[model samples]
Target: MRLTVIGCAGSFPGPDSPASCYLLEADHEGRTWRILLDLGNGALGTLQRFIDPLGVDAVLLSHLHPDHCMDLCGFYVMRSYHPNGAAPPIPVWGPAGTAEQLAAAYGLEDMPGMRATFDFRRYPDAPAGQIGPFSFTATEVVHPVPAYALRVSVGEKVLTFSGDSGPCPALVEAARDADLFLAEASFREVDDNPPDLHLTGRQAGETATAAGARHLVLTHIPAWFDVDTAEDEARAAYDGPLDRARSGAVFDL
Candidate 1:
């Protein structure tokens, strides 16, 4: 599987990167299967630089925050109004009421809203879905609104994404023994951070340490925070292969 970092900015769009969007691609049959982790602010424009929007096989949203799923509106337009023709509806897995929220955001009627462009499906708590060669597992994480920490596995290789979360057991459980853990280190360790919200750089590293993740990629740091600070804090807690996620960064496994 190939992991491409489309955006890594936290909470909102940054000057250099978009919000929180990731692209995962793997080979299935004779073609490549693609799935997007999130479609955050300013991701649509940047996404086309990597792959054609029509080639997206599925989109898995971590939550309903504008910074996490807002760009779906722009994606809906491209898929619904392509010059060649309307693109086929692709699966969109998200939190409960995801369909309603997207519909309201795009100002669409209740019936067939963005559903015409996207086949929106709510993530099931017990049995997660499998798409092509990937198996997805979503664990509820501590956040203001409904959100999840996602673990995607292809055979033995695994990639875990800690979608905006504070210190929690579920987050650790979701990332257990992951090959690559993409953690959000939005808040710094020195700040007076809140609970059940976001992770500090040290906290992100601690989670990676506890989960026994092989490689840790610190991401989702807002422009206000320095990546060096996050790396310094994370390095203190974890002693593994670590890298700061940046736009256009690619990881192959």
Candidate 2:
């Protein structure tokens, strides 16, 4: 499996990276199957640098926040207006009211919204969900908005994504034994952050440490903060291999 950091900025797009998008791809059948974890603000444009947007097999949205899901508007336009004809509807798994939320984000009527362009479905609650060679499970996490942490596994390798959550047991459960823990670190430990909204670098590290995740990648550091500080704070808690998610970085497992 291959994971690409298309965007890593938190809350909003940063100069160095766009907001909260990650591309996960793996070989299935005779070809590659690609799924995006999130398509946040400014992510659609950056995504083209890696793979054809039309080639994405599925998209799993973490929440309805603009920085986490606003690009569906542009994506809807792309697939619906392709010169060859409308592309096949891609499966989009997200929280409840996903179709309505995306439609509202795109200034469209809530009835159909992007339904014709994308097949929107609520994330499967139990027994996991499957598409091609991957299986993913979602766990509710601590966030003011309805958010989830996803744990995706293909064969023996596991990849977990903490999609905008504060320190919580659900986050630890979602990351348990993951080969790569792509965690969000939006606030510095020194700052006074709101509870149940986001995680500090230290909290992210603590979660990974508690989950026994093998590797940790700190992501979603807002543009206002220094990424180095998050890394430093994480290092103090986690002894495993740690990396900061940068635009275009690839991790093959």
Per-model CA lDDT versus the true structure? 0.93, 0.92
Model 1 lDDT per residue over 1-253, tens place: 9999999999999999999999999999999999999999999999989999899999999989999999999999999999999999999999998989999998888787888889888876433888899899888899999899999999899999998899999999999999999999999988888888999989999999999999999999999989999999999999999999999999997
**lDDT tens digits, residue span 8-111, model 2:** 99999999899999999999889999999999999999999999999999998888888989898899999999998999999888988889988887789998
Instruction: At residue 71, give the lDDT of candidate 1.
Output: 97
Off by over 4 Å in 1: 125-127
TM-scores, all candidates, are 0.98, 0.98
Clashes of 2: 0
